[model samples]
Target: MAHELIYMDNSATSPVDEEVLKEMLPYFNEKFGNASTLYRLGVDAKKALDKARQQVADLINADVDEITFTSGGTESDNMAIKGVALSEIQKATDKNPRNHIITTTIEHPAVLETCKFLEKFGFEVTYLPVDEDGLISLDDLENAIKESTILITIMHSNNEIGTIQPTKEIGEIARKHNVLFHSDAVQSAGKIPVDVKDQNIDILSLSGHKINGPKGIGAIYIKKGVRFEVFMHGGGQEKGLRSGTENMPGIVGLGKAAELARENLETRMQHNKEIRDALIEKVTSQIKDAYVNGSLEKRLPNNVHFRFSGIEGESLILRLDNEGIDGATGSACSTHDLKGSHVLAAIGVKPALSHGSLRLSIGPENSIDDVDYIVASIKKVVDYLRELSPLWDNETDEYIGDRFEKPLEDEDIDRY
Candidate 1:
């Protein structure tokens, strides 16, 4: 019999919830209409769009008017960063040209790449480094802020290592400095409590697929008083902030998902945490040189990151795939990059050790039995890979094979 697939990559994306799907089906055909029109069909769509906007706002405890739907997290992030930067640039003066952004080294590529793009236009960015547990120093963030700093765009929780930042504290600092704070909550929104008012956040971004909603849908929250230029301009959709024909089906799905997530947030978090903790305990106890990444106390309920010596993360993932387990080495967004994880590097992990990492993000569907099966499969695969690795000596836990006996000469390094 074929083994049943055990999915552990929820951080990458999740299966759309059945309830969310049910809520979306009608919009594809029966209720399909442009939300900007005044006819009955369009009026219904407009109602749905408003409800979804409110649902998304409730997830972060924001006013409904503050929410604006977007294509996805990337677009929302771009809009937040660029919208604010462009607005600041337009209002720049000789004495107060706010072109500086503050972010951490462990942020998702969505935020990092956006910051890099702004650098081309003479924007100065301060990428703060994190510690071994993938957490930033508040002092470092405070020290990085200057008179010219306009925005602090940090991620709420890291997608790779699952380290949750002190967003409230960061927000307080930004508020004190009179700087706008934007958090990429794409990974943390539904799974954790994200209260924009309580956290003192000015702008926030979240995705649909991460919370068991349809892909190609997301929402951005901008506090009422926070002003950024409109990101998109068209026939005046989304209150003229984001202008385009609304994705009716996707928006409905995201709305239903948000509603369900809010209603069952505690139950979902508890279940995921149970399975996540079990997997962590069993895997570390069963496998040698298995170290957990990020801070356990401040991590997401569903994230379990581990670094196993002697085996490449790609090999581990492939081996686990054969056994019906889905896992990841780093961010799904950066899997094709081939370089060692910048996230691991930021947390002080060596490139050699960073190569042997795995990220297993649990979901409500996972159970304790799934954790046991994953632990056994990983131990078996890691043992097999370590035996074949020239860099790993099982007995001594050191590299002592013939391959390591002699140092490569200048000419010997070019063979590969």
Candidate 2:
């Protein structure tokens, strides 16, 4: 085994920052108290919670009262989508009920699955398509809106391809149409600038673990005066939007992470971009049959997703593991399924090539040396995998098209 591990999967999750952990330590022990309680200890806990809330709100340029703490990204997403849906459904009359929601095809499962669940309850949904660069067309979004459209939900940045959508434009369109707009900003919150007020976003979701904070902590920014129904019912915490005893430690960690992110956003972004661009330049130039997966110019600074023909992404990932480098084939949440990534499919990547896609997301911790090492390891792994692939034709030094055309066998799918 290698002596040191090189982690490059920040898109999936990040290690807690030392400062964030330090801030959280006190909450887990001496300051442990229910934020909902009325006693002195509880008052102290409430003060901490409120301060953390202000930190999170400041990071996004949202009012403190508009931020609602939640379990994580998924919970925040579910609450935003379901909360809006539930509220709209309740206010609808049989004669003129608004039951429509518009979203992109490449959304995270939290948004997609919630929309899918709402479909069973007689809600109409429009799943907009993305272009080859994994970006949805503004025209498509504008056309999707209807008189009954209640919400327009889209992600600020893709978790897999790292494409940054035109959220400000989308927000403008939603505002003009009088529709509530929500964005899953989990992937973009700390790494990029997210101003809810300026963007005209009514609701936004973000997670702690995505930004070097502890897991199981996140927040949803619901614009004050927006008509949204409650998600969880108990204790009447979070202004009755999300109700339960708060995870004080995780909240404090998230606050510290947010504060740090705001303070060093420019430096952090520059560091990530330097490493990411270097890796992309080296890998694409040095490796054979390689292609970058998303819009290179309009993508997240920390993300580098690419595809190498005639090799399986999972196989490549495992080989990299042996070299002490960690990465991912796609969204960590969708790894269990053997089918091609939905984001790749939405972007028109061939199913065969989709299986060969790899995502390397760098964080502030990664250095120039780390980027060089990652590129070198990837080149070796891809070449080795291609040499062993049955689809590779040694005679022509090319991939066999017919072999790729073959459908995946059920047994083969199960192995992955």
- Give me the candidate number with maximum TM-score: 2
RMSD, candidate 1, Å? 4.0
Please list the C-alpha lDDT of all candidates, in the order they appear.
Answer: 0.89, 0.90
Superposed by TM-score, candidate 1 places the C-alpha of residue 347 at a distance from the truth, in angstroms, of 0.4
Clashes of each: 0, 0
TM-scores, each model vs. reference: 0.95, 0.96
Residues 1-416, candidate 1, lDDT per residue (tens digit)? Answer: 54699999999999999989999999999999988889999999999999998898898999999999999999999999999999898878888788999988778888988898899999999888788898889999999999999999999999999999999999999999999999999999999999999999999999999999999999999999877898688988888999889999999999899999999999999999999889888988888889999998999999999998777889999999999999999899989877778888777666667789999998777887777778889998998999999779868866433343343332221111
lDDT of 1: 0.89
lDDT of 2 by residue, 40-141 (tens): 889999999999999999999999999999999999999999999999988888775889999988899999999989999999999888888988999999
Clashing pairs in 2: none
- Predicted structure 2: clash tally: 0
lDDT of candidate 1 at residue 411, scale 0 to 100? 24
Task: Give the Å error, residue 168, model 1.
Answer: 0.6
Residue 204 accuracy (lDDT) in model 1? 95
